[model samples]
Target: MKKNTYLLPILRTAYESLTKSEKRIADCISADVTTFIGMGIAEIADRTDSSEITVNRFCKKLGFAGLQALKLALASVPSEEVISEEGFAKEDSYQHIAEKIFQNIQNGLADTLSLLDYDAVEEAVEALLAARRIVVFGVGNSATICQDFETRFLRFGSIVEAYSDVHQQATVASLLSAEDVVVAISHSGATREVLDTTAIGKAAGATVISITSRMGSPLAKLSDIVLIGMGREVRYRSEATASRLVHMAIIDILYTGIALRRKDYAANIAKMRTVIRVRKQ
Candidate 1:
């Protein structure tokens, strides 16, 4: 079995670089791993006799948002055990390959959920809900995700459009206004067509939101709000496979949030269902 590792290993690796006070915080967590997960930041700080800032800094050192994100990542360790046991291996049996693929997808979802910032998600939801027209820009695998996003929003009665071709994306983006919202989906955050369309959207004064893996990529740089997806890309998997799953998860979050906030969303869903049922009949 492969070793099950998560946030603890990251803390251990960064232990030497930490300040003496931060090391105390790390030591406290290392000593009582279970207790650390349930404890609040203030509680942990008090226990370690360190300021909350130090605790926050310690989490950032390990590439987390703060204490809450660190706890979320720590809470996912049990699932890592499942992933370890079902890890992909060369010459594996068909059953093993199936199990491994399923486990990897589960792990990716868990990681993406843990890494997501709820505030950013809420902001994205609000922007989508308030937009006069919603435009989604993507290409390749990311374009498929954009289509799903557009379809879901349209079901809720939003004026939404998705464009995969660069020319169409650019034309639509150029027509957007301040009241419009543009969601750009690119797993690598560097797709030229997506980037170009996003730039045009921004130049037109639309609120540009990006769903991507890189925080510092061009898409993110041009975006008004950046929603990050899982960055783990397996060598054996095709481009954007795992990332697309994460993107779809984010889309679901946005759709659910928006639906709940809309006044007649439930009625709209019921009406849509009835129409579909009639069409099938």
Candidate 2:
């Protein structure tokens, strides 16, 4: 785990890889991390119905040296940073469901904001400003976000394109030069098409920027600058829901930064408005 890695996400990501007993421990800890913070190895073992040895093994799997180390890491995470997966219950009232949904969104945004590295964000804005052409790539829900970014960048009168098709992305990447930039958006950061496109862009000398939740993901490794978003998966909603909101927020930050740097940004906006008005007439 990297510095400031949230415990709940780590447990969730590693859940599939753990043994049945280890999974029980993971579930117990993830459900209420604050409660687990005060627990000893013996207490955890009892809760999970496993031995102390099994609990130790589970801790090691999550990159902790021991139960003590794991607890320390969990303790470091602020209470607000822990994302609780509150699955929708069929027995719940409509108002209850609405409140839970709003709470999840609030937590997701706050977590992403906390995880953002402003230095990386500044570098990303500089790269965008310097590039002669910018190409954005994503698929599925991420592609929708890429398109939104493309639309936003157009206000700056820069050469930008968003490609959802894998073949188009490859072709665009093949033509990229050192003067170009590529922004790849992937929540998992392990999407095959997005990774391949990013690799091509890098090989062609374009500066690659990755927006992902996973810190040490393949996409992050390939990027010249990485903007991390902390979005947790919820059982009743699409996995990308919170991540998409974070991604949009990041895009807005970049858009604002780039707009501020351009001398004629206001003039460009006026011209765009005038053009729209003329078309309406």
Best by lDDT: 2
- Candidate 1 off by > 4 Å: 1-90
**Would you list the clashing residue pairs of candidate 2?**
none
Q: What local lDDT does model 1 show for residue 222?
A: 86
Worst lDDT run of 10 residues, candidate 2, spans 8-17
Least accurate 10 contiguous residues by lDDT in model 1: 79-88
Candidate 2 lDDT over 1-281, as tens digits, reads 45356676666545655789998998898688889888888999998999999998998877788988888888887676555777888898999988887777777677666567788999999999999999999998899999999999999989999999999999999999999999999988889999998999999999999898776577887899989775665788766687788788899999999988999899999999999999998
Candidate 1, residue 205: the lDDT equals 93
> 111-179, model 1: which lDDT tens digit per residue?
566556677888899899889999999999988999999888998788999999999999999998999
Model 1 scores a TM of 0.71
| Deviating ranges (above 4 Å) for candidate 2 | 1-73, 79-81, 91-93
Q: Predict model 1's lDDT versus the native.
A: 0.78
Cα RMSD, model 1: 8.3
